[model samples]
Every structure is written in structure tokens, then in C-alpha cells.
Target: MVLPGVYAPQEDTELLAGALSDEPLPPGAAVLDVGTGTGALALEAARRGGRVTAVDVSWRAVCAARLNATRAGLPLRVRRGNLFDPVRGESFDLILTNPPYVPAPDGTRPRGPARSWDAGHDGRLVLDRICREGPELLRPGGVLLVVQSALSDPDRTLGLLRTAGLKAAVIRRRRIDFGPVLRGREHWLRHRGLLSATDDKEELVVVRAELPV
Candidate 1:
């Protein structure tokens, strides 16, 4: 369940969850869920027997996650802070994220509900940061699973992870109809040449990156 201001579990969440369900994680593996909204992904990892830690910058999200974990009887370490900050110096065997990838005009990060989806122009603000910093928080042989819209450039994500020495590839993809945010920005996307005038759907991609042992 999602609280006000917390990101609700939607299509992207289901896609990431499906990918997570297919993965084979070691017993008692350490898992971190960055930008975990309502603890959905973290709970999924925990359900698979991973010792889960969830982080979010929004207090409401943190509370919602904690409550969900309690109701579900899962042991989740929920932290309220920016991505990875609350778990500095910690390494996880697996990391999962469904970060904001919606392209917006302003580079200024939003503090309201928009923070859940309004990524900067090109939608690489959070994506780039995750690609750059996530490797440091992974153990050798650790895996990072991230979901993003194709409009945000999955190729760049793969390239960035590969540059960071991880073998990355798109493990899963699903085409979904445009939501309110995309609908609102459809004209802008068309004007920017990122989307065709007739495009009403976007492909969501799940990227799996594995650090070498």
C-alpha cells in the first residue's frame, strides 16, 4: 500500500518484480533497494530470502515502506536519506532500483510528487548518478538490476555500466501506454525529436549488470 506522496507500485514496479523473481540470488544475500518506493522491491528481495535494506529520500516513502514491511512480517532496514547515503561503506550482493526516468524540461529536482518521476531533461539525472555510484556499493560478483524507460536511453545505461567494468544487458522489456506524465509531456517529447507524433507507448527496460569477481 502507498501513502500520500509515496510512489505507488505500478507497471514499472511489476516489471522489476518479475525480473527479480527470475533471478537466482544466493541464500541470505545482502540486498539494497535504492529509491525504494513503498518498499515493494525491497520486500520482493526479502521474500526471496535476501537480507534487505531499503533507502529513500522521502520521509513518507520511508514510513510507507516500514509499515508495509511490518504488515507483511518482513524484516526490512528502512532508511530515510538520499540514495546510498544511509548505507555508505556498505556493500550488497544485489541492488535493485526503479528510479525516476521521466524526461522533464527543468534540471531542478522536484521535492513533491514529481520527484517520483520528473527526471531532468533527457531523463538522465538520476540514471547517470545511479550508474556512476552504484558499482561502488556492490560486492565483487554483485548484480545491479535497474528499470528505466527506453526514452531515457537504455543504451547509455548499458554503456555506463560496461564502462564501470560490469557486464550489463537488457534482460527484459515491456511496452506500456503513456501515463499522465508522459501524456502531459508528449508534445514536448515530439518537439525534442525524442518521440514521434504518433507514439503513445514507451518501452520499459530492465537492465541487469553484474560486477566481475
Candidate 2:
């Protein structure tokens, strides 16, 4: 059950899951799900025979994920921490994340439910960190899959990962109408030149980055 303040699975989550499904997960592969929310992706990895570890910055999310895992009878290690803090020094075969990518009007850190999607002005506060730090946590030949909006600039994500020695590319794309958050910020986004005057949709892309063996 998703507790109050926890992010529910949305199109981005489904997109990432689709990418995960296509991946060849070996038996007992080590998997990490950052910003796990209700542990949907973590549970999916666990169901596929992966040893999954999920991390979230919110206690509500942590509790919700743990509860969901128990209900699904899946083995998921849920931890409460920011980004990679919970899994520091650990290596994983696969890392998945659907981080907060909506560009907020300000740079103040989000709290409560906003933490799930209210990324700072440029929307790269969390995304940039994931791109920079996520590579180091991957085991040789491992892959990192991230989902974010086109408004946030997927090209930068690819460049960052490639510079870190990973082969990065956009693996999936989906056009979705603006959700409540985006709709509310439509004017601000247009003011920032992130959206066209008549644009009412945003494209989400799944970026896959892999480390060489």
C-alpha cells in the first residue's frame, strides 16, 4: 500500500519497467532501485530472481516500499537515504531510477509529496547527481537505466554517462500529456523556454548507460 506522501507508479515508472523487462537479468543478479517509492521496480527485479536493494530519501516512501514488498511476498531491502547513500561502496549489476525531473520555479529542496517530482529550477538537481555518481556503483558490464522528461534534457544525461566511460543512449521514449504538476507549471516552463506556447505534452525517455567489462 502506498502511504501518504509516497509517489505512486506513473507512466515514467511503467516506462522504466518496460526497459527492465527487456533487459537480460541473470539469475541472482544484484539490482539497485534508487528513489524506489512504493518499491514497484524493486519488486519487479526481485520477482525476476534478482537480489534487489531499494533506497528512498523519505521515511514514508521507505515504509511504503517495505509494506508493499511484504504484501507481494518479494524480498526487497528498503533503505531510507538520499540517492546512493544507502548503498555506498556496493556494486550492482543493474541500477534503475525514475528521479524527480520536473523543473520547479525555485531551487529550494522539496519536501513531503513534492519530493517525488519537484526538481529544482533546471530539474537537474537529482538527475545530475545520479548521472555523476551512479556510474561508480555499477559493477563491470553493469547497466544503469534512468527515466526522465525531455524537458530536462536527456542529451546531457547521455553525455555525462559517456564521459564517465559508459556507453549511454536513449532506449525508450513515450509522449505523455502534462500531469497535474506540469500543468500547474506550464506558464513557468514556457517562460523558461522549456515548452512551446501550444505544447501540452512532454516526452519521457529511458536512458540506458552501461559500463564496459
| Candidate 2 per-residue C-alpha lDDT over 1-213 given as tens digits, one digit per residue, 9 for 90 to 100 | 778889999999999999999999998999999999999999999999999999999998999999999999999999999999988999999999999998999789988899899889899999999999999999999999999999999999999999999999999999998899999989999998999998888999999999999
Question: lDDT of each model, Cα atoms only?
Answer: 0.93, 0.95
- For candidate 1, lDDT tens digit of each residue in 127-207? 999999999999999999999999999999999999999999999999999899888888889999889878879999999
List of clashing residue pairs for candidate 1: none
Candidate 1 global lDDT: 0.93
Residue 65 of model 2: what lDDT?
Answer: 92
RMSD of 1: 0.8
What stretches of model 1 exceed 4 Å from their correct place?
none
